[model samples]
Target: MEPNPDREPGIPTDLLGVARIAGQSLRHIVGAVTKGAVHTATDLVDDIRSGEPISQIFDERVDLFRRAALSALGLTSTETGVPVETKVDAEDLKAMGDAMITEGWDSAQQPRELHPSFVPILHDLTPDEARILRFLAVAGPQPAIDIRTKAPFGIGSQRLADGINMIAAMAGCALPDRDHHYLGNLSRLGLVRFSTEPVADFRRYAFLEAQPPAQAAYRSVKMRAISSYRSIYLTVFGKQFCDACFVLGDYTGGGWAGDDRGDIYLGKGPRLP
Candidate 1:
């Protein structure tokens, strides 16, 4: 839905064919946006005759076109002034399975190089998640930690907080409070992965453990909190998406991410015991 093009990588001449394919897709979108121009004009006449405020009439016209465009693009189920049910029932599943086999057997059909899910995935990602991808692209893997109460022989350890990190602050997300939720959605989309294995540089965890949530967990358990080292990294699919969509500033080979970390995130975690 939004494009982040800060880095100026020139579009390669070899991508003309790719651009051509994109043009075909874009044409359908353009048509959808401008669908029923004549009908819209007639509707505008009716609105004006009904003595509606010119500003209100203009706003309604734009909103009508936007809904029509989205519906026409099949992004919404509203058609014929009725909303279609989107639940995929048994019949839909069987039809989809049959179609998959039919398509698989069709030797005449050429396989597409780019994935069909990319566009829909883009639509699914929020603005904050997009920023997170850009940050991960250059920042490398970031440190994450789970805070839990210490127990004898590691038995019955209660987790106080999990998946805590400074990603939202580092990425400059508008909604920093929702970083965990955003990360969860990104992981669900198969864009990023949360690894139980810590990043190679153990020093990063020192700062993360000092954060208020970890510190509170320690105090709550009377210095009996055990921090589990973890980290977040972009998956192969996520790396491709970031490379194609974002500007990776000061990016080096995938390695220690602390070089870009700021000192202000010490007590800023949202989760607590």
Candidate 2:
């Protein structure tokens, strides 16, 4: 799959998950090949020597290698996007053999990149889940209605609630039953917090401690309060979202006033008592 350039830098963590699946498949294929050749090894050798079953050997070996390769790559039986046909031609096999003779396969080495091709931060979350997180991170604490309004896809309140439930399920957390339950779960996870009062008829929520700090004091504070939270946020929004929200206030217009090009002042300058 092609990588999403819009995603944050760094390889996705989901790719590793796929690689692990692939590795397991490869091991199974190797076992199958060994088992298939065990009883007929002598007969196959005789046939090969006599040049009688040359095509049979080629076909069988090619099929075995192809299956093994597909399994190793974690490819499904049916191709979804990319063409996954097996390159089992004799010429290709001979070329691979020749390369192996010169370069040698590193048996000890394992695939390091298992991350998904999409945004690393969102490897675990679906599109809806990620959108929910992003919305929550930006809009602060909010009721389901308000949250839905701010979501990128304009998801309805019910759909947003469903996505939130899905996210909780994916994180191995409890599913929330009501609005308060959702807020409670998110608060417990430290991903969001509620305001003392509601906003615009909706409860306000904020993304608290979205990113762990680098310093010891910050780390200690976060560990005490935010450790239970999943690192999945790091993969979806990346560092920029947290940095802009916490430090720069860029997402909320940095408190700038559109009318006067200054901070929006709420207090009266001089009140006559």
Alpha-carbon RMSD, each predicted model = 14.8, 19.2
Q: Compared with the true structure, what per-residue lDDT tens digits does model 1 show for residues 83-200?
A: 3334555654454345444434534333354454566678789998898888888877889999888889888989989988988878888998899899999999999999998876
Over 4 Å off, model 1? 1-80, 86-92, 104-113, 249-273
lDDT of 2 by residue, 26-134 (tens): 2222322322232333344345457664444544443344443343333434422332444355554554345333322434222233322223333334433433444
| TM agreement with the true structure for every prediction | 0.60, 0.22
Total backbone collisions, model 2:
19
lDDT of 2: 0.33
Work out candidate 1's RMSD over C-alphas: 14.8
- Show the lowest summed lDDT stretch of 10 residues, model 2: 222-231
Model 2 / residue 233 / CA error / Å: 5.7
